[model samples]
Target: MRQTPDCVLDRPSVDDLDQFFSIVSDPRVWTHLPSGRLTDEEEAEAILVRLVFADRGLTAAQLGARLA
Candidate 1:
C-alpha cells in the first residue's frame, strides 16, 4: 500500500463498492476515464466486479479493451 499525507492507495474490495460507486458516479471523476459517468447502480456494480477481477491478474486495461 502507498500513502501520502492526504490519502492512501491500496487494492479495492467488495466492501468498497459503495464508496467506489459514489466517487465514479460523479461526472468530474470521468475527466480522464475512457467511459462517461455511470448512470446507475447496475453499471457501477458491473465495473466494481471487473475491478475485483483485475486485482487477480485479469488487468483492468485488458477488461476495458474487451469491453470496448
Candidate 2:
C-alpha cells in the first residue's frame, strides 16, 4: 500500500486505520502478552471503538513499549 508519510507513523493515518486494526486485532496476531494474558476480542473491539471513532489522539504506542 502507498502512504504519503505525513501523519505520524506510530499513530494511525485515516487510510491505514482499517488495515492496522485488521492486523493487530487478529487473534492469531495478538497472542499472549508479556505478562501472559491473552487478549479478548471484546476488549479489542472496545479499544478500537474508543481510539478510532472517539478521536482520542493518543497513539496506541503511547500506551507503552509493549503495544509499541
| Top candidate, metric lDDT | 1
Per-residue lDDT of 10-57 in model 1, one digit per residue for the tens? 988868888988988887888898387887888888888787877778
Model 1 weakest 10-residue run by lDDT: 58-67
Q: Per-residue lDDT of 5-59 in model 2, one digit per residue for the tens?
A: 6743455444564565576656666466443333465554556555654465655
Cα error of candidate 1 at position 13, Å: 1.0
Q: Using Cα atoms with residue i matched to residue i, what is each candidate's TM-score against the true structure? A: 0.63, 0.32
